[model samples]
Target: MATFSSKTFNSALYLSFRPGYNADFYKMLYDYHMRNNGQFDTAVDVGTGTGQVACVLAEKFKHVHGVDASAIMLASAVQKPNIKYHVSNGEDLNMIPSSSVDVLTVAQALHWFDHPRLFSEVKRVLKPHGTFAAVGYSFVMLENHPRASKRVYCLGNEPDQLGTFWDNGRLIVQNLYRSIEVPLKNVERHYFPDESGSELPLMMENVTMNHFRNHIKTWSSYKNYSEKHPDRPDIVDKTVDAILEEENLKEEDEVTLIWPTVLILAENNA
Candidate 1:
């Protein structure tokens, strides 16, 4: 598991800056699960960072439980009547009853988990024919501006310090979780659907350069970089300024950011 134990990592920023799954994505998951399992009573979202995905699950399921290893992140999660947040490791979810979960979801978080152990726990908690969905997001994109998009890409891929700061599990996400061993039955893989019912790129609108910077600040690699390279303190700021200057964008200018996600769905044989 990727530990967010470093003091430099801010859970609040993460919660505020990170994008949430849209209504279309949530509806698609529930529809798919019901089509196969014929029920949508309970769901468990593992590695539910700040309960973003859990909140979406709560809309369809009678009961929703979100589990995360970081207490600080859980502390800031929004509370919902049908959703209950808990501090638990993905590998061992003792808090959730065995064979009680109807569906299991890992939204943009599976890469950080111990895949084999997490899968074992999923099999244990899921009822017969239960569904497991592991979702991964690809690189962020900027619309109508290739330069700005490339800058975002460079920010993510460049900076040699990030290569070391990022956990090994990130490599799995970069590979679209294709190499992760998922021991389950009836596995299926696809891209998430947009609101238009087509598999389009996940997009967010009215974003600004400052908004992008804030989101970037929430990255684990950037946090680690700030801690280790105190001398090069202005690295993040300089990068953001350069992107804004290059794009000739004001701080409040609106831009579109798109994130493409991959979904891996499997069924519990038990």
Candidate 2:
């Protein structure tokens, strides 16, 4: 399998671990696209993980380009019609012609990008006045189940750093957007409705453990961590099994599970 670097993990990870985006999620995305563009036109889904966001872009935009550095990620996306899914690193976006896209978007994968390089490349690919949108969502343990929250935090990943460090608002700000590391001097973020419809949609919307696992598995950090610390699989499995024993497991039949997300949209000045 051809591996795409620049990302923490390769493409098979994209396919296996990434979560899905829900209908309300896509509707808001498309609505924002409409609001941003005055109409839904063409879009490029960057870091196209498992074609989850790609499928959403395809629904609204007539021309949807799904670009990734990984052949493994792109291969799975080719079957989708009216969409051009290609392999191109996020930093080196020369494969896409200048000013070709009406909107450029990413989902859970934005934090992994090299900030300066990604913002620059995004400027190059987007047409003058084109939109760049990104969003991410994760669980707030205390809201869903206090017991499971306490159990997972006490026994979950990095217990020592869990409570104060890994709290809800901070996680989304730091991990999802990389807000502090890379300030947006050239761009200003336009607010979009998250699944929760909260003023700051980045907050948790009653997410459960399975909801957390569904997407957490997609991240390269987790992949790298698990690879380095093989003990995690056992730990995660035991916790999940315990959850199953204690309460009914959240069930879904879709091959790719989706999440409600936080989206950021920015447009270059005309």
Candidate 3:
């Protein structure tokens, strides 16, 4: 979280490279929230870096609030009349009135939160039976390129590479937030690639290898590693080169990428 808050972190690049949730994902969340007669008056997006999720929620909810600790990250957020951006942490949303929000969501950021405090704030701000959703995607793999996928994994997990540079919160993200408990009722966990091996429709198709390279550069681990080893060769370029060599693909070659994503939803019964 601190890494992203840094002045030098490229929030725009991060926004461009990060995979986005599709309409189906929101449909699933909205369907779950509405299952118990949930309203769509107001929604709060905590840790809403660049307002990606908040911008989308604005189309559905009457009003939306995007809260983030990093003003730099929020600076890139899309300006929407219905969406209010707040410089606040997920654990303490004092600006929002209690028992007001109909839906609260955290996208790719629940792992960085103080779970107990965040859950308390979630309960305090959410109306009775309001919905809470947390969504995240884990390691990405190149479709039909097993060798390249393995190399990419090594780039992220090997101790000698960017692995050691990642914060402890990275593990929670890698684990797909399994360790997180919403401390609310009717909690549901959903996986993109279900046990039957059907992947979610969230796959990015026809993405260039160069795009993948830049995507790796947007990682916080990559930033930290680069800062600590300024003289060393760019590990991201090296990894991408290795993948291209092993797969016999050019930088312009397009490929499909799949991210194993997870979504957790709960209801504020209190």
Question: Against the hidden reference, what TM-scores do the models get?
Answer: 0.92, 0.69, 0.97
Residue by residue across 1-270, what tens digits does model 3's lDDT show? Answer: 999999998999988887778887799889998897999999999999999899999999999999999998998887799999999999999999999999999999999999999999999999999999999887788989988888888889999988899866999989989888779999988887777877554545458999888888988899999999999999999999988988899999999888888888899978
* lDDT (tens digit, per residue) of candidate 1 on 118-168: 888999999988989888876677778888777766766775636566765
* Superior candidate under TM-score, 1 versus 3: 3
Q: Cα miss at 246, model 1 (Å)?
A: 1.1
Best by TM-score: 3
Cα RMSD, each candidate: 2.6, 5.9, 1.2
Show model 3 residue runs off by greater than 4 Å: 198-205
Count of backbone clashes, every candidate in sequence: 0, 4, 0
RMSD (Cα, Å) of model 3: 1.2
Error of 2 at 184 (Å): 7.0
Ten residues in sequence with the least summed lDDT for candidate 3: 197-206
Instruction: Indicate whether candidate 2 or candidate 3 has the larger TM-score.
Output: 3
Candidate 3 backbone clash number:
0
Residue 43 deviation, candidate 3, in Å?
Answer: 0.7
